[model samples]
Target: MARNFAHGNYSHTQKKARNTGRTARDQTRRTLSQNFMVDRHAVDLMVKAAAPEGLVLEPGSGEGALTLALAEAGARVVGYEIDPRLAGQLAARTRNDPRIDVIRGDFTAARAPREPFAVVGNIPYSVTSKIVDWCLRAPDLTSATLLTQREYARKRAGDYGRWSLVTVESWPWFSWRLGDTIGRESFRPVPSVDSAILLLRRRPEPLIRGRRSYQELVELGFGGVGGSVRASLRTRYQGVDAALAAAGVPRDAVVGYVHPDQWITLWERLCG
Candidate 1:
């Protein structure tokens, strides 16, 4: 008992999702970091949040849990599956659906198209960082809604005073948000850890005009692990003190403690 695959109605869809969640529990593949998304609710939410404006880039399309929902949502989907078996099966299952094209390969190494797109995935935990970087670097990415490890999602969304270099580098252009959580039991194999959804929206008007240089500045500052922001940037760029003053960041502020807006202001003052 799967989705009716007809009207795409709420009850019909939910029934489909519920059935998948109940029956499709499979063992997670460690090499691929596979944790198949069995929860229908999470699938619907991910598809809606990042609703495909054009083509959607989906990696690790395990068991087509999210992929089916994505197609049902009317997205032109390009799903990448690393496992040959899964890829073959996905292609077979979706043979009649013109909206989806299942590609067999490593998505991280695949070049992104120059057209506008969005990314959605129940990401492979091991390569989450790598995948996010690829999406951030995509030329015309509108948004990315991902299902990541709960802890990773929290840290990226800055639920606490923690920020990764990629998150900092991506700050001026994209907004990160924490979405709903999926319990461990939601998957068939039931992972040891729970998962959470993460949303990233690209800014309509970039906070700063130049992207590469802005990222360089942010990395130079956040890359310093053991020193304050001003100290970290002092030797790299002249007038570091002035930039900090302009950004209202304290001379002794920890590099990680500085907010994204502060980084932007400082970069503008120094490089603008």
Candidate 2:
């Protein structure tokens, strides 16, 4: 025979159990950084921004949401998911679809396809920089459309009017743009920050020759040695003042304020 507990006590115990369960679920999601996109409109917007055709690579393909959408848009998708349960589910769900290939592995470790391809995904925020680095290094990559933290998208796209070192370095090969913003509410187990689409499309021809020297020049300019970009660049290159003037860079401008195009012009004037 079991003794009955007081109603208030029973209610309190139940509430604590529920709270614990909820906290565990939230913790798991956070640990994985897997805030999956649940809004149909957001998915459509991401697909549209990618305009994915031919072969496409998707990172963190949670539950096959964006993967199926990419296939629907006529893309041959190779989706990488690290979570075994989610990977198995996605693979089983898309087994009949010839357009989709689900791979259970770390996308960062995957090799780039020989043929040209576009990468599109609602990637895990924890590995956003790593994934972007992989996309940048892919020789045959044509474009990448990613749903990243709004702050990251803005920074990479130079939406804040200040350019990052990575963006400045990669500007010759890739054009970065900030696309649609997806509200935090659009995700299941909504993330603390909203997400935005970041589009990187490779140029048909690089903006400058001698990639190594151009990167070195950019590195020198960004060194911040003497305060201003003009000053920092002066430490290495001759005629930096003339180059700055030709590039339309202000004498007191910091490297972040200088545009990528201006950097190219500076390279042409100083090194070309």
Candidate 3:
């Protein structure tokens, strides 16, 4: 049974089971994705990496591990959790503290903040991409530290030279870093895949000033115009071959080899 912690009286009690014994392994609510992190070491790492101050936003707060950790690290925290049971636990744990707030619902649907805040989440795997978009577009965002699938973290950091559309588009503003792995055993339910932290720090000044044309350029190059950067851009815009030459990119070089520096040069010549 779920306990009530809504009256502002915080107390410690035995943790409740997620559901009745029957069908415990099966998925529950369609809207809620719950994975309570159980590893203290990994939790410590997240807190240290965040080194949070000011406001911190957490999605899928679960049982308050990240929320409490971040708050103790000096950040005023607001966490979103769709599970009533877990939400109640989180509320009870942090109610006496002035540094924390818990909201029960879908974070993706919430009105994002306009005041500068740092984000830290042991996020739901289902909404990882959505959270990435939310933080990147947040007008007041300072930095984001997210726990995501290892593969997702790698792509965001351009580990294999394969970047997502969001990664490419947000590159000028945020620098993405892949951090230490959190094993499957780190969670209570033991997810099939391992998770890792992704650190994104907003650049002081974008390597290239933010521009709408950059989005279009990302689509043209990565959207299968051709395998090579030279062929991709040259086919869509005039003088791209000459631009590539000026940027010091080889005509036959793969898009993977074309660095961010190259993209900036090409953008200036073609779109500026």
Candidate 4:
């Protein structure tokens, strides 16, 4: 007999039927990108990476695996699930657990808490960017540990030794890193690709001042005007050659090859 943690025990035939039902249900949830984490090891790894404490916000809390794990790890969790059935089930399941509050809604649309909090979840693949944007915009969000596509995580974390425009733009305020990778088999309805944990922790003190101007500089560098970052920036800043030298950036360096720290140095030299 196989035990369905979310539901209950099932015989072999019943398990087959349940799987079929899930496949059908998953068809309708394509827009939601509902891939439920079914592996306990994967759940444990996410919880460990997050090391969640105090208040935590969980997005796309399908089947309550991560939500329950987060609560067990001694954090007060507010889990948002867009699927009404899953949300209702989770709500009912955790009704007696004071630490867990299941909300049937969109996590991206939820308002940031006045007090400092952390966001942790196995988020929907389709809306990972949106949820990340929300976390970055929240003034009181101390950190976020999310399960996202491996490629997306690597890009944001600069795992491939190349920086992204968004990562550089936000680097002054948040530090991004890649955590453990979860195989596709970890999910109930296995996705085509593996997933990895993307960790973003807000800097206690921002690396730079004048965010608006710094972002503008970053934007101009990535605008692809004169090809290389050095040439592109020269169009706007007269001393760009000297600035690149000060930042240790090659005159012919591409924008994506420039590290965030180098970008900061460039900003200081050119705009400070």
Candidate 5:
């Protein structure tokens, strides 16, 4: 017999009904990422932290785990699922509930409605980068809660990790944080790698306010930075000079605390 999770203070009839539903899905679980959230404690914590005050968007809302919770917590939810089968399941689950809307589409290619919304998702491992980029590009998305591979979450959150180009570029617009570690057993088919949820909140405005030429400056900075770092010069001083010289950054604007990875901030400072 499979282990039974206690749903406290529930009548016998209710417990039986709930378990039956779970059992039915258990057979089809393989088709779903089916990691069907084993950690109720984590679920509660994620829901509490999200506190979706307004419209909330959930991309890759597999089987509606977080989506249903968000709606129950009084949030207005728009969930996008790439799998038609999962979308159908989600529609069935939320048919009686008016607060949730489920759509079937690829998140990267989909045109999200223009609205101020917070995003949350249990992201597919393969497209984590694209999903993060989408959230960053969506100006109206003020915050995001995402589950990703533990290593990626740690690096993005800057924990014991070197600054990356993506980090520097995104830092000006949002803050990244890793909330909790979820064990491998938490999902169906049990992936070998662990996962964690990350919270990101967008800044009210661009880190620098000026002629919208920051992108160009940043591109130039990276080229200079990359060239110097990859150069054969042994000494650190020589590399710095070479990079700055190659970049053509004005001598008067010499930056002392700059790193090769901080292209976004460096460019903004130089432009100012």
Candidate 6:
């Protein structure tokens, strides 16, 4: 027998012979955290951003909602899901598409595809930042559209606030935007919180080089220290003064807000 979880409430089915009245292991909601996207409009927006071009990868392909959409858009879509049941269903759903491939595995641990690809998915909120970092480190990733927590979406887009690490790190390689929010009611088992979609596009080349210059600078700005990496140059250069001066940053501008490439100019001049 199947139990039901709806409107944020968990309800078990009638008890039968030897039935403990709990949902089956596969049917029981996993504690993956905040699986809250039931809106078609939100799905449409993510697909639109991806544009269904070339090869596309979707991590956390829950229930195949967005996966079907991407396949319909004519993209060669590969979806990875950690849940075996979900993966099996998704695989069946898109098996005939030929362009779609479904993998059952942990996306965070999964190796990136050899070919260049774009990524799309409604990511698990708990590990959103780690996924973002994975996207950044992927050498051949072209772009990504992820449905994440609204707060994280804002931070990633740097919407009218100080740049978070994601914003600073991905600025040169990818641009980000916070799209619409999906309400709590949309999900089968409604989550306590809502979600927002974030779109990211990868850069063509390295924005700044010096081994780990941008990474180190970002660490410093955020008050993290490993090798004097956390010391803010903001006070020393009066903003980006130290970085700018060291990089021979020609103009009287700050390196912090400058494009990653321009910041590279400073790094090359100063650190090299």
Candidate number of the best lDDT: 4
lDDT of 3 by residue, 1-272 (tens): 22222333122223334556624324442234556789899999899888899989888888887788888888999888766667777887777888898886667766778788988999988889888888887878899999999999988888877666677677788888999899989987777889999999999888776478886886788766678887787777999888888889888887766667677788888987
Clashes of each: 1, 0, 0, 0, 2, 4
Model 1: per-residue Cα lDDT over 1-272, one tens digit each = 11111221222211222334443222225445777877788777777777665789898887898988988888888888776557778888988888888887777877888898889998888999989989988989899999889999999988787676777788888999898888887876577999888999898987888887888888778777448888778767889888888888899998777888888888888777
Residue-level lDDT for 67 in candidate 2: 96
Residue 217, model 2: lDDT of 93
Q: Regarding TM-score, does 4 or 5 come out ahead?
A: 4
Q: After superposition, how far is residue 85 of candidate 2 from its true place, in Å?
A: 0.8
Candidate lDDT scores, in order, read 0.79, 0.87, 0.79, 0.88, 0.65, 0.66
The TM-scores, one per candidate, come to 0.84, 0.91, 0.86, 0.91, 0.72, 0.74
Candidate 1 local distance difference test against the native: 0.79
* Candidate 2 lDDT by residue in tens digits, 94-131: 88888998887778888899999999999999999999
lDDT of 4 by residue, 1-272 (tens): 11122222212212222445456455546656879999999999999999999999998888999999999999999888776667778888888888998877777777889999999999989999999999999999999999999999999999999999989999999999999999999997789999999999999999998899899999999999989998889888878888898899999999999999999999998887
Off by over 4 Å in 1: 1-28
Put down candidate 5 lDDT per residue, 52-118, tens digits, no spaces: 7688888767767788888888889888775555777887888778798887666676555588888
lDDT of 4 at 24: 44
For candidate 1, the 10 contiguous residues with the lowest summed lDDT are 1-10
Give the Å shift of residue 24 in candidate 6.
4.7
RMSD of each: 8.7, 9.5, 5.5, 6.6, 10.6, 7.4
